[model samples]
Target: MTTYTLNQENLNAISERVSTPKYNRTQLTTGIVHIGIGGFHRAHEAFYTDQLLHDTSITNWAICGVALLPHDTKIYQTLKAQDGLYTLMVKEFDGSLSKRVIGAITELLFAPEDPSKVIEKIASPEVKIVTLTITEGGYNYNEATGAFDDKNPSILYDIAHPTQPKTVFGYLTQALKLRQQKGLKGITIQSCDNIQGNGDMTKQMLLSYVKLADPALIPWIEQRVAFPNSMVDRITPATTAADIEQLKTEEGIVDAWPVVCEPFKQWVIEDQFSNGRPLWEVVGAQFVKDVEPYEKMKLSLLNAGHSVLGILGALVGYTTIDEAVNDKNIHAFLEHYLKQEVVPTLSDLENVDLEAYIASLLQRFGNVSIKDQIDRICSESSAKFPIFILPTVKANLKLSRQTELAAFVVAAWAIYSLGTNEKDEHLNIKDALKDTLHKQAELASQNHPEYFLEIESVFGNLKTSKPFVDAYVKAYKTITKEGVIIAVQNINLSQINSI
Candidate 1:
């Protein structure tokens, strides 16, 4: 067994089972600076860019990954050591797997190591795009006020000392300032996060930050920058130890931070960028005039569906998405929720088959080889609910639609937050709102369910509505008394009424 550590040196020696870059890696140069180099970006965006790079003519769209936080330190080191190469394993529904070495990332920068260098790279005339996968929570958004969090410690620090900054907002701000000072053109700040209006949100947040910290740059930014909304999709799981082991044994490739994703992928962009299009449509991206409809549809059905399985599945002792969605009753519950509670709100989309999309979501969620973790789906859920599930839930409530399924999912989240499953097994809950939700969950468990809904930012004013509150409390109690499987098995959700 001849195993090669994934790097520029091993590129030629990689097994015939794995695909390596066909073009000259030396010709590829970074024109895209993407922040938050998580598994999804590697699996989705970088994968697409790598595919697009197959045409040697498109060499400048290579990615320079920017890891901004302490957690990103590992990936930064791994990618830097590998010469921005990582093996991508694409798993299909029937359990088939294909591997490729994604060389679209030509450089990796840890911002904490030197923020100034990141700014310098972004300010370079060759770089015309800065992208982000900073999850919904990373926006530093206050949903209640519908604005960027002005008083956030990092935002404030960035405001005070624009030269040395902490957050993405600051890094972007300082970089643009450097560009502006040097008479360099603005870079399009595209956001590929799960947020509904991601590009718009990126623009709004940056504008708000600039108003507070660098008001003078506002006029220049308004004229030069482009923040195009986009809808990106791929079921990429965090690489587990098993994945690393499998890659090493099967393909003879030792990758430090390899990426694993389902074969399904989609990217819909608004066709607005200061930089010319990367011709990504050739590689299967939809460059459209509008991305909102796509965003709303995918977020409501796919993302919301993941949350349904993630929260409910966790409560039922299911550890991965396939295990949960593959279960007969839970699968039925998911279909019922999508067809009944989630579909009605997606009126904005045209020419799209909603039913087909729902069916595809089920297939994506049940991709066994991907082994997408329930904990990964549930992680950062506090930020996800507002972007993914709540809009559909709220829209249904406004129309007086049946929200029992959605309510049950939320109730399951409340129970799942308790850090213990029905089997008394410890649930490794990973949410920024864990502590607060746990406290609220305790209160809700003790008879005041509205206390949990009191977080106006997350749940909104849903606490004030009697019908929603009653449905929520009843579902919460049903999960508590009857357990999660029994609760989800009730497709009509009659079990919730038993309380």
Candidate 2:
């Protein structure tokens, strides 16, 4: 029988580390307000915060987690059930593991439950840095224009009644307004999303929304807020019952909420904070003058490679990336795609060896125990494509010749939009452009094969380039006639070299 409920003993047993030696929980205060409290935050930022708490200098940096959607309430309930204590398991491919109980989060607030409470927390003077892990779609930017969509009801509502309807931007604007009113020191806004120039992106969206709402707050935000771009990497799969049972049996403790992540972790920050930040460099974070090259390397190589594997894995009926990577054709496809197409386009990667990086990525994808799902990776492709594939495509296209391997990725994305697996089973696609894609696919099936390219938001700028258009059309034709596996097999280094 289980011997513990919401007691500190149970928490200590589950974490495998005693809290008394690490953190003075009573002394902790809400200094950092995390906007999107998802699984990634629980595993990554919160994990770092937990480590920083041990130093006592930053015990006050305890996280105040906020959830914007209804679905997140469940996470809130689970965390609250465990007295804000949960286990984070880092599993390696070789079976070595580490587990820790994270207690960095001091409180959880659901926007829907109490919007005022959320705004009040963000407006508080104690909150120093506001971090976000809201997935690509959460930003509410229009893919076509690369700008904020004022037409979005959420944005419109937030703008119409700033204090009444709270969004990440709304909360930020209100908090800044409060800071302005009180003449308090400004805070840094750190974006932990995978988007390139994430800090700039967040600043743009916030300012755009603010300009529409109140023009007066613009200069105030300009002088006070500092948006720092960052590159964050961690492979954390969705938790399952099997994971729960394994932990229960292995550790003799049951945690309603536990985070499982791959052994690999990275956090690269731009080192531009307004009100100061923790000495996270001591805890393995890289603080650099320029994160652009690193950001490009990570987004283009690691993220783009992940997307390629994910789409192909789903189409081939493979559940996890490990299974997909094990297939000879898939493995060869990735190797060729990265080496012949993706690698050649990236310039000035510091001391990074592209070959070694690709090998490491392959190893991570082949970790069968991690079980990173293709569908999970495939979600929010619209937001991911611009960062992951577009730059490579543009770079390859600018060369004297066009690269078919890069074109194949675009073609594969079009094929993926058809919404069926290799077995012809319907696939559940999650994207901001889902409705438009369905209609576009229907039109293509009827007679307008070129309609897919007409998605100006996605392919609009590329459509003007004849070489890219020709490559895309040719690859799309091949995919339609021969299927993905054969198409991928036929692609070679010579084809990319020709471009």
Candidate 3:
């Protein structure tokens, strides 16, 4: 039982074990510098770029993956050891698996180890596209104010020490300053996170950061950088010990850091690059003039839909997303929310079969192999709701459409923030506003929905809306009284009766 390590030497040996990359690795040159290298980036962006490198003409579009955290040192070491090659297993809806060796990342850099090297790479004229997946909170944005929070301690630290910065905005500002000083061309900054208008938001945050840190570089940055909005989708779960062992036992390959995801992957990008970009369109990426509709559709429908499943699933003692979606009531609740509440917020798009999209999401959510956890989806609820759920709530309110389901989703979050499930199991609360949320949750436990809703940072003035208040109060009382499962079943019954 010989175990083959995932590296260039073992590529040929493990041909039967996994899908080894066919392109020549040695000839690949770094054209893109990707920040916040994580499981999603490896599965989505790097996966697409890896496919593009198959064409000999596009050999220069290889990625130099950089992890900016001290916690990323292990991943940085693992990726470096394997020459930036790792396994990507795509779990299909039919329980089928497609395993491939992603070789798009030719270099790996740990910013904590060598900040100068990382800055130099991003500042290089050869690197035309700088991408990020630094999560929602990483932007240092105050969602309530719709602006970058300059007072954030991290931003403050980065502002004070520009050269040795900690956050992504600081690095970008410093890198752009270097480019300006060197008379180098500007580069595109693409954000592949789940945030809405990711590119526009990044641009706003970066410009604001520059203005506060170094005002002189603001105009240069304004002229040079292009933050194109994008919608990236894939259900890549956190790699576990079981996944690692399964790869070795089943595939006979030992990968230190492998990304596991669903078979479906999509990247809808606005075709606006400052200097130049990889021919991503050649690899199934949609390059369009406007990414707003697509972004809204995905965020409001898929992302917000996940939160609904997560909070509800967590409450009913469901562990995985598959387990949650498999429940008839939870599944119906998701579909109802999507069709009744979420879809009406957007106008029709060209060639976009949203029905098909919802069906695909249903299948994706029910894929047992991926085992997407409710806790994982529920992790960033505080930051996520403002981006994903609140928009639809706002839209539906203006249209005067039924907001019962939307209000339920937010109420489900309020209930979940109590940090315990129906079984009295201790739940993990991962949010920037954890203290405030807990305080509000304690107050809300006494049947005061206003305690949670009045967190103007998240709900805004929506707390004052009588319709939303009525719906949220009813849902909150129902769940607390009848239990999570019964409340879901009751909602479905009511919907059926109304029809």
List, residue by residue over 171-253, the lDDT tens digit for candidate 1. Answer: 98888988999998777999999888898899899999989988999988999999999999988898999989999999889
- Position 434, candidate 3: lDDT: 88
- Tell me, by lDDT, which candidate is best: 3
Q: Write candidate 3's Cα lDDT for 1-499 as tens digits.
A: 7899998888899887667778888887788999988999999999999888875467888999999988888989999999899999888777787889999999888988878888899888789899999999888888778878888888899888878888998888888889998999989999999998999999999989888999999888888889999999998888888888988999889998899999888899999999888888888999999999998999998898788888999998998898999999899989988988888887758898889989988988888999987888998788899999989988888878889988887787888899999999988877879888988988998969768897887777888899999999999998889988888888988877776
Pairs with steric clashes in candidate 3: none
TM-score of 1: 0.97
Residue-level lDDT tens digits of model 2 in 159-181: 88887775788878887888889
Q: Clashes in candidate 2: how many? A: 2
Better of 2 and 3 by TM-score: 3
lDDT of 1 at 222: 92
Query: For model 1, what is the error of residue 434's alpha carbon versus the real structure, in angstroms, after optimal superposition?
Result: 1.4
> What lDDT score is found at residue 484 in candidate 3?
81
**Which stretches of model 2 miss by more than 4 angstroms?**
1-9, 13-21, 55-57, 446-448, 493-499
Candidate 1 CA-lDDT value? 0.86
Q: Locate the minimum summed-lDDT window of 10 residues in model 3.
A: 51-60
